[model samples]
Target: MTATPRTAVVIGCGTTGTSVALALTAAGTSVALVDDDPGAVAEAAALGAGTAWTPGLPPADLVVVSTAPSAVADAVHDAQSRGLGHVYTDTAATKDIVCAEAELRGCDLKGYVPGHPLAGADAPGRDDADAARFTGRPWVVCPYETTPAWALETVDALIAACGAHRVDLAPHVHDRIAAELSHAPHLIAAAYTTRFADSSEAFLRLAGEELQAAVRTAGGDPWLWGDVLAHNAGPVADVLDRVAGELARAAAVLREGDSCAPLELAPTLQEGRRGQLALQRAGHGRTARDAPAGGRG
Candidate 1:
C-alpha cells in the first residue's frame, strides 16, 4: 500500500480544511488544525478534526491551507514563513491570482503547490464537514516549475489520504477551467435565484428538479464567491459572455415563435445537451476508476 501522510497541519478550519483534516485522521494521520478565530479552532476540535495548534510544535509532513481564495496566498506565506511542514499546499478555488499573489508576497514558491478540490457543500464550517467530501472528486494541482519533487510527493500523499484523483494543469489553465466549471456557474445560479426571490410561495413551490439544480449554488457563501470572481474575472467573463450570447439568441428565437427542424434554439440546445453528456461521462469515468477492485459499482 502507498504510504499516506503521517502528520499534517491544516490551516483555515473551514469546510474544505475541516474535511481534509478529518480525512487525514481517518487515514491514521495526526492532524493539527488551525484557524484565525478561537471559535473555529474549538469547533474543529469538538468535531475531532484535530488538536488545536500550539506554538513550537514539530513540523509535520504536509501543510494544507483551505482558506478562502482571497486569503490563500497569505495563509500559505504564513505557513511557510513559520516553517510549518515539509511541503505547503492550498485548496483555494482560483489558482492564477493566488499563485501570483504568493509570488508577489515573496512566498517560498518551491515549497507551495496550489490546488483546488472540485467538491463542496452549501453549508460552511466544521460542523458540516465530511471526510468523504473529496472522495472520487477531481483535485486540480498547479505546481510551480521550481517546486521540489519532495513537495509534490508530500501533496500526493495528502490527496491519497482524502481519496481524491489528482490532475495536473498550469495555473492559468486551472483558472480558466475553474471559471467555466465553477465560477460562471455560480454567477448564473445566483442570478437565476434572485429572479424568483420576490415571487409568491406558490412560485417557489413550483420549483422542480431542474430549477433546483439551476439555483443550487445560489446558496453558496457570497463573500467567498465575490472574492473568487474578483480574482478570476477575466476567465469568468469570457465564459459568461458566450453564455449571454447563447441566451440572447434563444430569446430571439422564442420571440419570433420559431420551432421545428434546424431552428436557432435547436443548435444551442443540442450543444448544451452534448456538454452535459460530456460531464456525465467524465463523472462516470472518475467513479469507475476510483471504485474498489472487483466491486459492483
Candidate 2:
C-alpha cells in the first residue's frame, strides 16, 4: 500500500464528480473527468479539471464513481473488466448494497472504498461544482475488511485535500445512521413543503423566511434522492416506523390533553431537543463543543 499521488478518473461529471475532479487535480493528480454529458465534461475541464469523454476502463490510478447508487455496480463491473485503475471509490449515499454488488462483481475489495460526503447544496449539476464545497464537512468512509490499508490512506488524503474530516463506519451502520439523520428529515421536509404548493400564490407569498428555510432541501434533485432512499429502504423504514410510533403517541397526548400519562412526553421532548442540538453542532462543524441552546420539534 503506497501513498503516491497518481492519475485519477472521476466518472459522472455532475456536481459531486466535478468537485472530486477539481480536488484531485489541485492535489497534483492528473485527473480524467468523464461523464455521459459532453457539455458537463467541457464545463469541468474549463474549471481546470481533466477532460475525457470515454474513460476506457480500469481508470488511471484511481476511479471515482460519483453517480447514483443504482448505477454503481455496473460502473464498478465495467471498470474492473477494463482494469481501469488500481483503486476505486464511490460517493453513493447508500453503501451496503453497493458493497454487496462489488463483491458479486469480483472487484478487488482491497482496492475499493465506499464514501459519502456530508456537505452539498440544494443546487445540482456541474455548474454548481465547487472545489471547496466539502471543506470542513464530514466525509463518511465505509471500508470493508478486505480494503487495503493503502486504499484507506489514499481516501483519507483525498478527504484532507478537500478540507473535509473523515469519519469511519461500517456500511450498514453508515446507512442506518444516514436514514435516521438525513433521509427521514428530507422526507419530512418534502412532505411539509408539498402541503403548501396547492395554496394560492398570494397566500404562499405571505410565508416567512423560516418556513422557506425549513423546506429548502426539498428543492434538490428528486431522481438523486429517489435512488438514495430506494437503495436504503430497510433502514429508512425502521426510522420511519419509530417516527410513526412517536407521532401516534403525540396524537394520543394531544387528544387526551393529559401530560401525565404512562407515555411521558418529557422524555420525548428532551430527546428531540438533544437531536436538534446534535444536528446544529454537526452543521457547524462544532460537534466536539457545546451546541446552541435552541431546540426544534
Candidate 3:
C-alpha cells in the first residue's frame, strides 16, 4: 500500500467530509478542511475536525473531494489545477457519471480513484458528523485499468485510516449497485412518505414504529438525492420500474381481497421476508463488522 497519508485536504465541510476530517485527525494525520461556505468550515473546525484550508500551502499527500455527486467533476478539476494533492478520491455515491465527467473535464485519472463510503445518516444535518461514521463500513473504490497503483493504495490507506474496509469495483458496477442499494431506495422511501404531507397532527401522532422505520430514508436531502438519481437515472429507473410492477401486482391483489378470507398477499409477504433475511445474512440491517468487504465486481 502507498505510505499512509501524513497530510490531507478534504474539500467539503458537510457531515461526510467533516467525518472524514475528524477520523483522519484522530488517526494523527494533519488535515485541512475546505468549503465555499466559511461558516461550514468554521463549524467543522470548531468540532476539532481540522483547520480550514486556504491556498498557498504545500500539496497534501491526498485530497478527498467530498462534494455532492453533481459537483464532483468540477471540484476534482479545480483541486488538481491548484495542485492540491498527489492523489485524489471522491465520496460520491454514483461512479460512472463522475468518472465520465471527470474524464471529459480532462482530470488526471492516474492520480484519482472514485470512491464512496457506504455510511451516512438518512437526514441532512451538519451536526451529525461522527468521527466513527465509517467505522467498519464498506468503502468502495472504482478504479480504471489505467489508475496507478499509488493512487489506489493512497485511497486504501484513507479508507483504512477511517476504520473502513476497502472494496474495489469498476465504475459501471459501482453505479449499478448504488442505484439498487441506495439511490432507488431513497426515492421509493421519499415517494411513499409523501403520503403524510397533508396528514393531520392526530394522524401523524398515531404513527407507529413500523411506519417511521419504513420511511427512514425519506428524511435525506432531496436535492442531493435528486442529483444522485439523475446521475444514475437509467439503473435507478430500472429498479424503480421493477418495484412498481411488484407493488402494482400487490395492489391488484389487495383490491380483489376479502378481509375475512385467507390472504393472497402471502407470496408477496414471503418474498419480502426472504429478501430481508438474505440482506440480514449478507450483514445489512445489522452491525458493520458483519458486512462483507469484497466487491461483486
Candidate 4:
C-alpha cells in the first residue's frame, strides 16, 4: 500500500531530530517530539517543532530515531517494542553496526528502513535546528532484504515532505561513503584546528577565511564525534591514511631546499582544484530549487 505519514513521532530531540520535526510540522504533518531528556524535548517544543510525546499517545505512521550512532539500535528496538510507529528509521551516521544490532535484537525488519540524512550542524541542541536543513540534501535509505515495499514508500514520502531527494544504498556502502564524505573530513578538520588550540590571541588574529573554512567542521562535540569515529573506524581509518599520505608527500616536497620551487607543488594543487570544480559541477549544497532532480548513488 502507498503511504504518507499523517502523524509522526520523532524519538530524539537533538539538532537533527528537532529539525526533522520542524520540517514535518511545517509540511502539515502532525509531529510529536520525544527524548530521554525531557528538557531537550521541551526545548524543541519551544522552538515550535512539535508537542512533547506522552507514553500513551497513539502510534504514529512513522517514527524517526535520530540518536547518536551508538544509541540508534537500542532506541529503534525500544521504539518498536513500544509500538511507536508503523514504520521506523534511524538517522545514525554508521549503518552497518546499527542495522546489525537491530537484527540481533530481533526488530521487525519488514517495517524498518535504515536511513541517514546527509545534513548536520555542529550544535547538538535545538539552537541550530532548522526546517530547511534537509532541503536539497541527499538522504540515504538502506533497505533490508526483508523490508516491505510499503515501508520504503513511507520513508520516501517522509523524505519528500522534508524537501530532500532519496538515494538508496547497501548498508556497508553507506558506511564507507559516510566515512569518506563526513567522518574522515570532520576528523581531519579537528586535526587541523588542534594547531590553533594553543595559539595566542595575537597569532589567531592573523587567521583568514581560508583557515576558518578548513576547520569549520571541527566545532562538533568530541564525544559525539568520537562515537561516530569508533563505530566507523575501519572505513574512516582507510580514508585518513590516504589523506595523511598525500599531506606527508606535500610536506616532504616543501622541506626540500630552494632548488625545489613552490611551483613544484602544481600537481597536488591542480588535483585539488579539479576535485573542487567537480564537486561544484555536481550541484552539492545547492538550495532545493537549484539542486538536480536525482540524488547521487
Number of the top lDDT candidate: 3
* C-alpha RMSD by candidate, in order: 2.0, 4.7, 3.7, 3.1
Q: Please give, for residues 164-261, the per-residue lDDT of candidate 3 as tens digits.
A: 88888888898899888888988999998898999899999998999888789898877888888899999999999999999898788777777822
Better-scoring candidate (TM-score), 1 or 4: 1
Ranking by lDDT: 3, 4, 1, 2
Ranking by TM-score: 1, 3, 4, 2
Which pairs clash (backbone N, Cα, C closer than 3 Å) in model 4?
A: none
How many angstroms is residue 138 displaced in model 1 relative to the true structure, after the best TM-score fit? 1.6
Two-way lDDT contest, 2 vs 4, winner: 4
lDDT of 4 by residue, 1-297 (tens): 244579999988988899999998998889998898999989999999999888798889999998888998888888999998999998888998889988998888888899999884556547999998988788999899888888998899889888888899998899999998889999999998888899999999999989887778898878889999998999999999999998888888878856664787888889899998987766554543445666433
| C-alpha lDDT of all candidate models, in order | 0.86, 0.80, 0.88, 0.87
**lDDT of each residue in 110-144, candidate 2, tens digit only:** 88898998776655656778887887678999888
The TM-score obtained by model 3 is 0.92
Candidate 3 lDDT at 156 equals 85
How good is model 1 by TM-score?
0.93
- TM-score of every candidate relative to the true structure: 0.93, 0.85, 0.92, 0.92
* Error at 117, model 2, angstroms: 1.8
Q: How far off is residue 143 in model 3, in Å?
A: 0.7
**Lowest-scoring 10 consecutive residues by lDDT in candidate 3?**
288-297
lDDT of 1 by residue, 86-202 (tens): 789999899998999999999999889989888855654457799999987889899998988888888888888888989999989999998988899999999878888799998
How badly does each model clash, as a count of residue pairs? 0, 7, 0, 0
